[model samples]
Target: MKWSEICIHTTEEAIEPVTNILYEAGAGGVVIEDSQDLQQTFLSDEGSEYSLDPADYPIDGVNVKAYLPVNSFLGETVEEIKQSVNSLLLYDIDLGDGRLTFSEHNEEEWATAWKKYYKPVSVGEHFYIVPTWENFDPEDPNRKVIELDPGMAFGTGTHPTTVLCIEALETHMSKKAEVLDVGTGTGVLAIAAAKLGARKVHAVDLDQVAVQSAKINVKLNKVQDVVTVSRNNLSDNVKGQYAIVVANLLAELVIRLAEGGVADLLQKDGLLIASGIIRPKKEQVKEALIKSGLHVIEEMDSGDWIALVAEKAE
Candidate 1:
Protein backbone atom coordinates (compact mmCIF):
# COMPACT_ATOMS: atom_id res chain seq x y z
CA MET A 1 0.00 0.00 0.00
CA LYS A 2 1.11 3.57 -0.68
CA TRP A 3 1.01 6.25 2.03
CA SER A 4 1.23 10.04 2.01
CA GLU A 5 3.63 11.46 4.53
CA ILE A 6 2.40 14.86 5.79
CA CYS A 7 5.04 16.88 7.56
CA ILE A 8 4.63 20.14 9.47
CA HIS A 9 7.53 22.35 10.46
CA THR A 10 6.50 23.88 13.77
CA THR A 11 7.71 24.73 17.26
CA GLU A 12 8.21 22.43 20.22
CA GLU A 13 5.26 24.05 22.02
CA ALA A 14 3.00 23.06 19.13
CA ILE A 15 3.96 19.38 18.91
CA GLU A 16 1.30 17.82 21.15
CA PRO A 17 -1.70 19.70 19.76
CA VAL A 18 -0.61 19.37 16.14
CA THR A 19 -0.04 15.63 16.52
CA ASN A 20 -3.56 15.33 17.95
CA ILE A 21 -4.96 17.26 15.00
CA LEU A 22 -3.27 14.88 12.57
CA TYR A 23 -4.47 11.83 14.49
CA GLU A 24 -8.03 13.16 14.49
CA ALA A 25 -7.69 13.68 10.75
CA GLY A 26 -7.14 9.90 10.23
CA ALA A 27 -3.36 9.71 10.25
CA GLY A 28 -2.10 6.32 11.37
CA GLY A 29 0.86 7.54 13.46
CA VAL A 30 3.19 10.50 13.97
CA VAL A 31 6.94 11.16 14.08
CA ILE A 32 8.60 14.15 15.74
CA GLU A 33 12.01 15.58 14.81
CA ASP A 34 13.24 18.35 17.04
CA SER A 35 16.38 20.30 16.24
CA GLN A 36 17.13 20.51 19.95
CA ASP A 37 17.48 16.76 20.30
CA LEU A 38 20.78 16.91 18.42
CA GLN A 39 22.31 18.89 21.27
CA GLN A 40 21.36 16.49 24.08
CA THR A 41 24.36 14.83 25.75
CA PHE A 42 24.38 11.12 26.50
CA LEU A 43 23.93 10.11 30.10
CA SER A 44 25.44 6.63 29.67
CA ASP A 45 28.19 5.06 27.58
CA GLU A 46 25.60 2.91 25.85
CA GLY A 47 24.01 6.07 24.39
CA SER A 48 27.28 6.89 22.65
CA GLU A 49 26.99 3.82 20.41
CA TYR A 50 23.80 5.09 18.75
CA SER A 51 24.60 7.76 16.19
CA LEU A 52 22.02 10.18 14.82
CA ASP A 53 21.90 10.85 11.12
CA PRO A 54 21.93 14.59 10.50
CA ALA A 55 20.18 14.18 7.18
CA ASP A 56 17.02 12.93 8.90
CA TYR A 57 16.46 15.98 11.10
CA PRO A 58 15.66 19.61 10.51
CA ILE A 59 18.34 22.20 11.21
CA ASP A 60 15.77 24.62 12.64
CA GLY A 61 12.35 24.32 14.28
CA VAL A 62 10.61 20.91 14.68
CA ASN A 63 8.95 18.59 12.20
CA VAL A 64 5.86 16.49 12.98
CA LYS A 65 5.21 13.85 10.35
CA ALA A 66 2.17 11.60 10.03
CA TYR A 67 1.23 8.86 7.59
CA LEU A 68 -2.12 8.70 5.75
CA PRO A 69 -3.10 6.11 3.18
CA VAL A 70 -3.18 7.41 -0.35
CA ASN A 71 -6.69 7.32 -1.70
CA SER A 72 -9.04 9.08 -4.17
CA PHE A 73 -9.78 11.71 -1.53
CA LEU A 74 -6.16 12.26 -0.49
CA GLY A 75 -6.18 15.85 -1.67
CA GLU A 76 -9.27 16.71 0.35
CA THR A 77 -7.82 15.04 3.42
CA VAL A 78 -4.56 16.94 3.08
CA GLU A 79 -6.43 20.22 2.71
CA GLU A 80 -8.44 19.47 5.84
CA ILE A 81 -5.27 18.70 7.77
CA LYS A 82 -3.78 22.00 6.69
CA GLN A 83 -6.86 23.93 7.77
CA SER A 84 -6.94 22.25 11.15
CA VAL A 85 -3.26 22.88 11.81
CA ASN A 86 -3.71 26.52 10.82
CA SER A 87 -6.48 26.79 13.39
CA LEU A 88 -3.95 26.41 16.22
CA LEU A 89 -3.21 30.12 15.86
CA LEU A 90 -6.57 30.77 17.53
CA TYR A 91 -5.06 29.27 20.69
CA ASP A 92 -1.91 31.41 20.38
CA ILE A 93 0.26 28.35 19.74
CA ASP A 94 3.54 29.18 18.04
CA LEU A 95 3.79 27.35 14.73
CA GLY A 96 7.31 28.64 14.04
CA ASP A 97 8.01 28.24 10.33
CA GLY A 98 4.51 26.73 9.90
CA ARG A 99 5.41 25.08 6.62
CA LEU A 100 3.38 22.04 5.53
CA THR A 101 4.93 19.57 3.12
CA PHE A 102 4.17 16.04 1.91
CA SER A 103 5.52 13.13 -0.08
CA GLU A 104 4.44 9.65 -1.17
CA HIS A 105 6.15 6.57 0.27
CA ASN A 106 5.68 2.84 0.66
CA GLU A 107 4.15 1.30 3.78
CA GLU A 108 7.44 -0.35 4.70
CA GLU A 109 9.28 2.98 4.81
CA TRP A 110 6.54 4.59 6.86
CA ALA A 111 6.74 1.84 9.48
CA THR A 112 10.42 2.26 10.35
CA ALA A 113 11.29 5.88 9.48
CA TRP A 114 10.43 7.32 12.90
CA LYS A 115 12.21 4.84 15.14
CA LYS A 116 15.70 6.29 14.81
CA TYR A 117 14.63 9.69 16.20
CA TYR A 118 13.39 8.20 19.45
CA LYS A 119 15.91 7.32 22.15
CA PRO A 120 16.06 6.97 25.90
CA VAL A 121 16.23 10.47 27.44
CA SER A 122 16.98 11.35 31.00
CA VAL A 123 14.71 14.11 32.30
CA GLY A 124 15.04 15.83 35.65
CA GLU A 125 17.23 14.30 38.35
CA HIS A 126 15.40 11.07 39.00
CA PHE A 127 13.55 10.04 35.84
CA TYR A 128 14.52 8.50 32.50
CA ILE A 129 12.05 8.40 29.62
CA VAL A 130 12.98 5.23 27.77
CA PRO A 131 11.46 4.14 24.52
CA THR A 132 9.97 0.64 24.66
CA TRP A 133 12.39 -0.68 22.06
CA GLU A 134 15.46 0.57 23.92
CA ASN A 135 17.18 -1.43 26.64
CA PHE A 136 17.99 1.11 29.36
CA ASP A 137 19.39 0.53 32.82
CA PRO A 138 19.67 3.58 35.01
CA GLU A 139 23.21 4.29 36.11
CA ASP A 140 21.82 5.09 39.56
CA PRO A 141 19.61 2.47 41.15
CA ASN A 142 17.56 5.14 42.90
CA ARG A 143 16.52 6.79 39.63
CA LYS A 144 13.03 6.05 38.31
CA VAL A 145 12.37 5.08 34.69
CA ILE A 146 9.24 5.50 32.55
CA GLU A 147 8.97 3.13 29.62
CA LEU A 148 6.83 4.76 26.89
CA ASP A 149 5.59 4.18 23.37
CA PRO A 150 3.76 7.41 22.52
CA GLY A 151 2.32 5.98 19.31
CA MET A 152 0.26 8.75 17.67
CA ALA A 153 0.02 10.83 20.83
CA PHE A 154 2.44 13.46 22.18
CA GLY A 155 4.55 13.78 25.35
CA THR A 156 7.81 11.90 25.02
CA GLY A 157 8.69 13.39 28.43
CA THR A 158 11.86 14.87 26.92
CA HIS A 159 10.40 18.17 25.75
CA PRO A 160 11.51 21.10 27.87
CA THR A 161 7.97 21.84 29.01
CA THR A 162 7.52 18.23 30.09
CA VAL A 163 10.92 18.12 31.72
CA LEU A 164 10.09 21.20 33.78
CA CYS A 165 6.84 19.61 34.87
CA ILE A 166 8.66 16.43 35.94
CA GLU A 167 11.25 18.50 37.76
CA ALA A 168 8.50 20.30 39.63
CA LEU A 169 6.87 16.96 40.37
CA GLU A 170 10.08 15.68 41.88
CA THR A 171 10.38 18.74 44.08
CA HIS A 172 6.80 19.53 45.12
CA MET A 173 5.01 16.19 45.01
CA SER A 174 4.26 15.03 48.52
CA LYS A 175 4.28 11.39 49.56
CA LYS A 176 0.72 10.06 49.53
CA ALA A 177 -0.57 13.19 47.83
CA GLU A 178 -3.49 12.85 45.46
CA VAL A 179 -2.50 14.45 42.13
CA LEU A 180 -4.36 15.63 39.05
CA ASP A 181 -2.62 15.80 35.66
CA VAL A 182 -4.63 17.88 33.23
CA GLY A 183 -3.87 17.36 29.54
CA THR A 184 -1.87 14.29 30.47
CA GLY A 185 -0.30 13.34 27.14
CA THR A 186 1.63 10.06 27.18
CA GLY A 187 0.91 10.02 30.95
CA VAL A 188 4.55 10.92 31.59
CA LEU A 189 3.91 13.46 34.32
CA ALA A 190 1.21 11.29 35.86
CA ILE A 191 3.51 8.28 35.88
CA ALA A 192 6.26 10.41 37.36
CA ALA A 193 3.89 11.51 40.09
CA ALA A 194 3.11 7.90 40.85
CA LYS A 195 6.78 7.02 40.90
CA LEU A 196 7.48 9.98 43.15
CA GLY A 197 5.16 8.55 45.82
CA ALA A 198 1.86 10.22 45.07
CA ARG A 199 -0.73 7.90 46.58
CA LYS A 200 -3.14 8.43 43.66
CA VAL A 201 -2.96 10.18 40.28
CA HIS A 202 -5.90 11.10 38.06
CA ALA A 203 -4.47 11.53 34.57
CA VAL A 204 -6.93 13.24 32.26
CA ASP A 205 -6.78 14.24 28.58
CA LEU A 206 -9.50 15.27 26.17
CA ASP A 207 -7.90 13.29 23.32
CA GLN A 208 -8.87 9.62 23.20
CA VAL A 209 -5.61 8.63 21.53
CA ALA A 210 -3.69 10.38 24.28
CA VAL A 211 -5.84 8.67 26.91
CA GLN A 212 -5.03 5.30 25.38
CA SER A 213 -1.35 6.14 25.07
CA ALA A 214 -1.24 7.29 28.68
CA LYS A 215 -3.03 4.13 29.79
CA ILE A 216 -0.46 2.01 27.98
CA ASN A 217 2.49 3.92 29.44
CA VAL A 218 1.02 3.95 32.94
CA LYS A 219 0.65 0.18 32.70
CA LEU A 220 4.11 -0.20 31.18
CA ASN A 221 5.64 1.76 34.05
CA LYS A 222 3.69 -0.43 36.49
CA VAL A 223 1.81 2.60 37.80
CA GLN A 224 -1.72 1.68 36.79
CA ASP A 225 -2.41 0.86 40.41
CA VAL A 226 -1.56 4.44 41.27
CA VAL A 227 -2.51 6.34 38.10
CA THR A 228 -5.95 6.28 36.48
CA VAL A 229 -6.22 7.46 32.88
CA SER A 230 -9.45 9.21 31.89
CA ARG A 231 -10.91 11.33 29.09
CA ASN A 232 -11.85 14.78 30.37
CA ASN A 233 -11.45 18.36 29.19
CA LEU A 234 -9.33 20.37 31.55
CA SER A 235 -10.94 20.00 35.00
CA ASP A 236 -14.49 19.91 33.71
CA ASN A 237 -15.57 16.45 34.86
CA VAL A 238 -13.09 15.94 37.67
CA LYS A 239 -14.56 15.74 41.13
CA GLY A 240 -13.17 16.63 44.54
CA GLN A 241 -9.83 18.30 44.95
CA TYR A 242 -6.22 17.34 44.57
CA ALA A 243 -3.07 18.04 46.55
CA ILE A 244 -1.28 18.91 43.29
CA VAL A 245 -2.50 19.83 39.80
CA VAL A 246 -0.05 19.89 36.89
CA ALA A 247 -0.86 20.99 33.35
CA ASN A 248 1.60 21.21 30.48
CA LEU A 249 -0.56 23.04 27.95
CA LEU A 250 -0.52 25.98 25.57
CA ALA A 251 -0.40 29.38 27.22
CA GLU A 252 -3.89 30.32 26.11
CA LEU A 253 -5.30 27.05 27.42
CA VAL A 254 -3.61 27.67 30.74
CA ILE A 255 -5.15 31.14 30.85
CA ARG A 256 -8.57 29.73 30.04
CA LEU A 257 -8.27 27.12 32.77
CA ALA A 258 -7.26 29.79 35.23
CA GLU A 259 -10.17 32.02 34.24
CA GLY A 260 -12.47 28.99 34.41
CA GLY A 261 -11.71 28.40 38.07
CA VAL A 262 -8.85 25.92 38.06
CA ALA A 263 -8.17 26.86 41.66
CA ASP A 264 -11.42 25.20 42.71
CA LEU A 265 -9.96 21.89 41.65
CA LEU A 266 -7.20 22.17 44.20
CA GLN A 267 -7.11 21.62 47.95
CA LYS A 268 -6.10 24.52 50.15
CA ASP A 269 -2.39 25.13 49.87
CA GLY A 270 -2.29 22.78 46.90
CA LEU A 271 0.28 23.29 44.16
CA LEU A 272 -0.34 23.98 40.49
CA ILE A 273 2.51 23.36 38.07
CA ALA A 274 1.72 25.17 34.81
CA SER A 275 4.08 24.63 31.86
CA GLY A 276 4.20 24.96 28.04
CA ILE A 277 4.48 28.72 28.12
CA ILE A 278 7.08 30.41 25.96
CA ARG A 279 9.03 33.24 27.55
CA PRO A 280 6.95 35.84 25.74
CA LYS A 281 3.78 34.63 27.45
CA LYS A 282 5.21 33.77 30.85
CA GLU A 283 4.06 36.92 32.62
CA GLN A 284 0.65 36.73 31.01
CA VAL A 285 0.19 33.22 32.34
CA LYS A 286 1.46 34.24 35.74
CA GLU A 287 -1.07 37.07 35.89
CA ALA A 288 -3.86 34.71 35.04
CA LEU A 289 -2.76 32.31 37.76
CA ILE A 290 -2.66 35.13 40.25
CA LYS A 291 -6.16 36.20 39.28
CA SER A 292 -7.34 32.65 39.89
CA GLY A 293 -6.25 32.96 43.53
CA LEU A 294 -2.99 31.12 43.06
CA HIS A 295 0.18 32.61 44.52
CA VAL A 296 3.36 32.01 42.66
CA ILE A 297 5.72 29.80 44.62
CA GLU A 298 8.41 29.09 42.07
CA GLU A 299 9.29 29.48 38.39
CA MET A 300 11.44 27.23 36.20
CA ASP A 301 12.90 28.17 32.88
CA SER A 302 14.61 26.01 30.28
CA GLY A 303 15.55 27.53 26.95
CA ASP A 304 12.63 29.77 26.00
CA TRP A 305 10.06 27.74 27.95
CA ILE A 306 8.82 28.49 31.45
CA ALA A 307 7.03 26.42 34.11
CA LEU A 308 5.31 28.07 37.01
CA VAL A 309 4.48 26.54 40.38
CA ALA A 310 1.66 28.24 42.23
CA GLU A 311 -0.17 27.45 45.45
CA LYS A 312 -3.78 27.95 46.47
CA ALA A 313 -3.96 30.78 48.92
CA GLU A 314 -5.13 30.06 52.46
Candidate 2:
Protein backbone atom coordinates (compact mmCIF):
# COMPACT_ATOMS: atom_id res chain seq x y z
CA MET A 1 0.00 0.00 0.00
CA LYS A 2 1.09 3.59 -0.65
CA TRP A 3 1.32 6.12 2.20
CA SER A 4 1.55 9.87 2.55
CA GLU A 5 4.65 10.78 4.47
CA ILE A 6 3.87 14.00 6.31
CA CYS A 7 6.77 15.99 7.67
CA ILE A 8 6.77 19.15 9.75
CA HIS A 9 9.88 21.25 10.30
CA THR A 10 9.27 23.02 13.58
CA THR A 11 10.91 23.95 16.84
CA GLU A 12 11.77 21.48 19.56
CA GLU A 13 9.28 23.09 21.92
CA ALA A 14 6.44 22.32 19.51
CA ILE A 15 7.27 18.61 19.16
CA GLU A 16 4.71 17.31 21.64
CA PRO A 17 1.76 19.40 20.44
CA VAL A 18 2.54 18.82 16.76
CA THR A 19 3.00 15.06 17.19
CA ASN A 20 -0.25 15.07 19.14
CA ILE A 21 -1.95 16.86 16.28
CA LEU A 22 -0.85 14.13 13.85
CA TYR A 23 -1.99 11.36 16.20
CA GLU A 24 -5.38 12.97 16.59
CA ALA A 25 -5.65 12.98 12.80
CA GLY A 26 -5.20 9.16 12.71
CA ALA A 27 -1.41 8.83 12.53
CA GLY A 28 -0.24 5.53 14.00
CA GLY A 29 3.40 6.46 14.66
CA VAL A 30 5.58 9.57 14.54
CA VAL A 31 9.29 10.13 13.95
CA ILE A 32 11.13 13.11 15.44
CA GLU A 33 14.46 14.40 14.10
CA ASP A 34 15.96 16.96 16.41
CA SER A 35 18.67 19.21 14.94
CA GLN A 36 20.27 19.38 18.33
CA ASP A 37 21.18 15.72 17.98
CA LEU A 38 23.86 16.72 15.47
CA GLN A 39 25.90 18.08 18.38
CA GLN A 40 24.85 15.68 21.12
CA THR A 41 26.84 12.76 22.47
CA PHE A 42 24.51 10.11 23.83
CA LEU A 43 26.91 7.60 25.39
CA SER A 44 30.37 8.21 26.81
CA ASP A 45 31.99 5.82 24.35
CA GLU A 46 32.29 7.79 21.10
CA GLY A 47 32.96 4.55 19.19
CA SER A 48 29.52 3.18 19.91
CA GLU A 49 27.12 2.36 17.06
CA TYR A 50 24.84 5.31 17.92
CA SER A 51 25.26 8.04 15.32
CA LEU A 52 22.82 10.48 13.69
CA ASP A 53 22.87 11.13 9.96
CA PRO A 54 22.55 14.80 9.05
CA ALA A 55 20.31 13.98 6.11
CA ASP A 56 17.68 12.68 8.48
CA TYR A 57 17.48 15.97 10.42
CA PRO A 58 16.41 19.46 9.50
CA ILE A 59 19.15 22.01 8.91
CA ASP A 60 17.89 24.52 11.46
CA GLY A 61 14.99 23.04 13.38
CA VAL A 62 13.24 19.82 14.43
CA ASN A 63 11.32 17.62 12.02
CA VAL A 64 8.25 15.60 13.01
CA LYS A 65 7.31 12.93 10.49
CA ALA A 66 4.45 10.48 10.20
CA TYR A 67 2.95 8.15 7.63
CA LEU A 68 -0.72 7.66 6.80
CA PRO A 69 -2.26 5.36 4.23
CA VAL A 70 -3.47 7.10 1.07
CA ASN A 71 -7.23 7.20 1.06
CA SER A 72 -10.17 9.22 -0.24
CA PHE A 73 -9.93 11.55 2.77
CA LEU A 74 -6.20 12.17 2.37
CA GLY A 75 -6.50 15.78 1.24
CA GLU A 76 -8.99 16.64 3.96
CA THR A 77 -6.83 14.92 6.56
CA VAL A 78 -3.76 16.90 5.53
CA GLU A 79 -5.67 20.16 5.67
CA GLU A 80 -7.05 19.35 9.07
CA ILE A 81 -3.61 18.47 10.39
CA LYS A 82 -2.19 21.75 9.09
CA GLN A 83 -4.97 23.81 10.62
CA SER A 84 -4.75 22.08 13.97
CA VAL A 85 -0.96 22.47 14.25
CA ASN A 86 -1.10 26.08 13.14
CA SER A 87 -3.63 26.67 15.89
CA LEU A 88 -0.95 26.05 18.50
CA LEU A 89 0.27 29.65 18.05
CA LEU A 90 -2.92 30.67 19.89
CA TYR A 91 -1.40 29.00 22.94
CA ASP A 92 1.82 31.08 22.61
CA ILE A 93 3.83 28.10 21.45
CA ASP A 94 6.85 29.02 19.28
CA LEU A 95 6.54 27.07 16.06
CA GLY A 96 9.84 28.25 14.64
CA ASP A 97 10.49 27.54 10.96
CA GLY A 98 7.19 25.71 10.78
CA ARG A 99 7.23 24.22 7.30
CA LEU A 100 5.00 21.37 6.19
CA THR A 101 5.66 18.94 3.35
CA PHE A 102 4.35 15.65 1.99
CA SER A 103 5.80 12.82 -0.04
CA GLU A 104 4.71 9.39 -1.19
CA HIS A 105 6.34 6.17 0.03
CA ASN A 106 5.70 2.46 -0.13
CA GLU A 107 4.78 0.48 2.98
CA GLU A 108 8.18 -1.25 3.12
CA GLU A 109 10.23 1.99 3.18
CA TRP A 110 7.84 3.59 5.66
CA ALA A 111 8.22 0.64 7.99
CA THR A 112 12.01 0.77 8.29
CA ALA A 113 13.21 4.30 7.38
CA TRP A 114 13.17 5.59 10.94
CA LYS A 115 15.27 2.82 12.42
CA LYS A 116 18.58 4.39 11.39
CA TYR A 117 17.98 7.42 13.61
CA TYR A 118 17.04 5.45 16.72
CA LYS A 119 19.22 3.26 18.94
CA PRO A 120 19.74 2.32 22.56
CA VAL A 121 21.44 5.08 24.59
CA SER A 122 21.82 6.03 28.19
CA VAL A 123 20.10 9.08 29.69
CA GLY A 124 21.43 10.78 32.80
CA GLU A 125 23.11 8.50 35.33
CA HIS A 126 20.57 5.77 35.92
CA PHE A 127 18.25 5.45 32.93
CA TYR A 128 19.10 3.70 29.65
CA ILE A 129 16.68 4.12 26.75
CA VAL A 130 16.27 1.07 24.53
CA PRO A 131 13.99 0.78 21.54
CA THR A 132 11.77 -2.32 21.69
CA TRP A 133 13.19 -3.52 18.35
CA GLU A 134 16.76 -3.89 19.61
CA ASN A 135 17.94 -6.79 21.75
CA PHE A 136 20.75 -5.25 23.75
CA ASP A 137 22.00 -5.01 27.31
CA PRO A 138 23.77 -2.15 29.03
CA GLU A 139 27.35 -2.55 30.22
CA ASP A 140 26.17 -1.71 33.71
CA PRO A 141 23.72 -4.27 35.01
CA ASN A 142 22.46 -1.70 37.51
CA ARG A 143 21.46 0.83 34.84
CA LYS A 144 17.68 1.13 34.75
CA VAL A 145 16.46 -0.02 31.34
CA ILE A 146 13.43 1.77 29.86
CA GLU A 147 12.06 -0.11 26.86
CA LEU A 148 10.02 2.14 24.56
CA ASP A 149 8.56 1.98 21.09
CA PRO A 150 9.90 5.36 19.97
CA GLY A 151 7.90 5.25 16.76
CA MET A 152 4.82 5.51 18.95
CA ALA A 153 6.06 7.98 21.58
CA PHE A 154 7.24 11.60 22.00
CA GLY A 155 10.87 11.57 23.24
CA THR A 156 13.93 9.42 22.51
CA GLY A 157 16.09 10.50 25.49
CA THR A 158 18.34 12.73 23.34
CA HIS A 159 17.00 16.11 24.48
CA PRO A 160 19.06 17.96 27.07
CA THR A 161 16.10 19.36 28.98
CA THR A 162 14.89 15.80 29.52
CA VAL A 163 18.31 14.62 30.67
CA LEU A 164 18.63 17.49 33.15
CA CYS A 165 15.21 16.60 34.54
CA ILE A 166 16.20 12.94 34.88
CA GLU A 167 19.42 13.82 36.70
CA ALA A 168 17.56 16.06 39.12
CA LEU A 169 15.05 13.33 39.79
CA GLU A 170 17.84 10.92 40.56
CA THR A 171 19.46 13.32 43.02
CA HIS A 172 16.50 14.87 44.86
CA MET A 173 13.47 12.60 44.51
CA SER A 174 13.08 10.33 47.53
CA LYS A 175 12.17 6.70 47.74
CA LYS A 176 8.43 6.02 47.85
CA ALA A 177 7.81 9.69 47.14
CA GLU A 178 4.58 10.33 45.32
CA VAL A 179 5.63 12.06 42.06
CA LEU A 180 3.71 14.55 39.97
CA ASP A 181 5.34 14.71 36.51
CA VAL A 182 3.88 17.74 34.80
CA GLY A 183 4.29 17.80 31.00
CA THR A 184 5.41 14.20 31.06
CA GLY A 185 6.49 13.74 27.41
CA THR A 186 6.65 10.06 26.44
CA GLY A 187 6.13 9.33 30.15
CA VAL A 188 9.90 9.04 30.52
CA LEU A 189 10.10 11.19 33.62
CA ALA A 190 7.13 9.43 35.15
CA ILE A 191 8.83 6.09 34.51
CA ALA A 192 12.13 7.45 35.80
CA ALA A 193 10.41 8.45 38.99
CA ALA A 194 9.06 4.95 39.34
CA LYS A 195 12.48 3.40 38.78
CA LEU A 196 14.03 5.69 41.35
CA GLY A 197 11.45 4.40 43.84
CA ALA A 198 8.53 6.79 43.68
CA ARG A 199 5.51 4.87 44.92
CA LYS A 200 2.78 6.76 43.08
CA VAL A 201 3.27 8.89 39.95
CA HIS A 202 0.72 11.10 38.22
CA ALA A 203 1.89 11.93 34.70
CA VAL A 204 -0.07 14.83 33.21
CA ASP A 205 0.06 16.55 29.84
CA LEU A 206 -2.27 18.87 27.97
CA ASP A 207 -1.74 16.98 24.70
CA GLN A 208 -3.78 13.82 24.15
CA VAL A 209 -0.97 12.42 22.00
CA ALA A 210 1.45 12.66 24.87
CA VAL A 211 -1.09 11.26 27.27
CA GLN A 212 -1.63 8.23 25.07
CA SER A 213 2.07 7.81 24.28
CA ALA A 214 3.00 8.14 27.92
CA LYS A 215 0.39 5.59 28.90
CA ILE A 216 1.88 3.08 26.48
CA ASN A 217 5.41 3.85 27.66
CA VAL A 218 4.41 3.55 31.31
CA LYS A 219 3.09 0.07 30.61
CA LEU A 220 6.07 -0.79 28.41
CA ASN A 221 8.39 -0.01 31.28
CA LYS A 222 6.18 -2.10 33.58
CA VAL A 223 5.53 0.90 35.76
CA GLN A 224 1.82 1.00 34.94
CA ASP A 225 0.92 0.39 38.55
CA VAL A 226 3.03 3.31 39.73
CA VAL A 227 2.36 5.94 37.04
CA THR A 228 -1.08 7.21 36.03
CA VAL A 229 -1.23 9.17 32.76
CA SER A 230 -3.80 11.92 32.24
CA ARG A 231 -4.55 14.84 29.95
CA ASN A 232 -4.57 18.17 31.79
CA ASN A 233 -3.00 21.59 31.56
CA LEU A 234 -0.17 21.85 34.06
CA SER A 235 -1.49 21.44 37.58
CA ASP A 236 -5.02 22.68 37.08
CA ASN A 237 -7.65 20.44 38.66
CA VAL A 238 -4.97 17.95 39.75
CA LYS A 239 -5.67 16.48 43.18
CA GLY A 240 -3.37 15.09 45.83
CA GLN A 241 -0.17 16.74 46.98
CA TYR A 242 3.09 15.17 45.93
CA ALA A 243 6.50 14.84 47.54
CA ILE A 244 8.16 15.56 44.22
CA VAL A 245 6.84 17.46 41.18
CA VAL A 246 8.74 17.80 37.89
CA ALA A 247 7.74 20.21 35.11
CA ASN A 248 9.77 20.15 31.91
CA LEU A 249 8.00 22.90 30.03
CA LEU A 250 8.94 26.15 28.36
CA ALA A 251 9.81 29.17 30.49
CA GLU A 252 6.49 30.92 30.04
CA LEU A 253 4.43 27.85 30.91
CA VAL A 254 6.71 27.08 33.83
CA ILE A 255 6.18 30.67 35.02
CA ARG A 256 2.45 30.28 34.53
CA LEU A 257 2.46 27.10 36.60
CA ALA A 258 4.57 28.81 39.23
CA GLU A 259 2.17 31.75 39.37
CA GLY A 260 -0.69 29.26 39.44
CA GLY A 261 0.69 27.86 42.69
CA VAL A 262 2.13 24.64 41.30
CA ALA A 263 4.17 24.52 44.44
CA ASP A 264 1.01 24.15 46.48
CA LEU A 265 0.69 20.69 44.98
CA LEU A 266 3.80 19.66 46.84
CA GLN A 267 4.02 18.49 50.41
CA LYS A 268 5.98 20.50 52.98
CA ASP A 269 9.59 20.85 51.90
CA GLY A 270 8.93 18.75 48.85
CA LEU A 271 10.94 19.39 45.67
CA LEU A 272 9.88 20.89 42.36
CA ILE A 273 12.13 20.38 39.31
CA ALA A 274 11.40 22.92 36.56
CA SER A 275 13.27 22.66 33.24
CA GLY A 276 13.02 23.54 29.53
CA ILE A 277 14.00 27.10 30.24
CA ILE A 278 16.57 28.52 27.89
CA ARG A 279 19.49 30.23 29.59
CA PRO A 280 18.28 33.74 28.78
CA LYS A 281 14.95 33.07 30.50
CA LYS A 282 16.42 31.38 33.57
CA GLU A 283 15.99 34.35 35.90
CA GLN A 284 12.49 34.98 34.65
CA VAL A 285 11.39 31.45 35.57
CA LYS A 286 13.27 31.52 38.85
CA GLU A 287 11.57 34.75 39.90
CA ALA A 288 8.16 33.33 39.14
CA LEU A 289 8.81 30.19 41.14
CA ILE A 290 9.96 32.21 44.12
CA LYS A 291 6.91 34.46 43.91
CA SER A 292 4.68 31.40 44.07
CA GLY A 293 6.35 30.04 47.25
CA LEU A 294 9.14 27.78 46.06
CA HIS A 295 12.64 28.29 47.36
CA VAL A 296 15.30 27.77 44.73
CA ILE A 297 17.52 25.01 45.98
CA GLU A 298 19.89 24.45 43.06
CA GLU A 299 20.17 24.87 39.33
CA MET A 300 21.59 22.60 36.60
CA ASP A 301 22.18 23.17 32.94
CA SER A 302 22.39 21.03 29.83
CA GLY A 303 23.81 23.31 27.14
CA ASP A 304 21.54 26.35 26.66
CA TRP A 305 18.68 24.87 28.68
CA ILE A 306 18.38 24.96 32.49
CA ALA A 307 16.60 23.03 35.23
CA LEU A 308 15.71 24.62 38.55
CA VAL A 309 15.36 22.42 41.60
CA ALA A 310 13.24 24.18 44.21
CA GLU A 311 11.55 23.27 47.47
CA LYS A 312 8.32 24.23 49.17
CA ALA A 313 8.65 25.72 52.61
CA GLU A 314 8.23 23.38 55.55
Top candidate when judged by TM-score against the true structure: 1
Worst 10 residues of 2 by lDDT: 41-50
Off by over 4 Å in 1: 43-51
| Whole-model lDDT per candidate | 0.87, 0.84
How big is the positional error of residue 163 in model 2, measured in Å on the Cα after superposition?
Answer: 1.0
Error at 134, model 1, angstroms: 1.4
Which residue pairs collide in model 2, if any? none
After superposition on all CA atoms, how large is the RMSD of candidate 1? 1.8
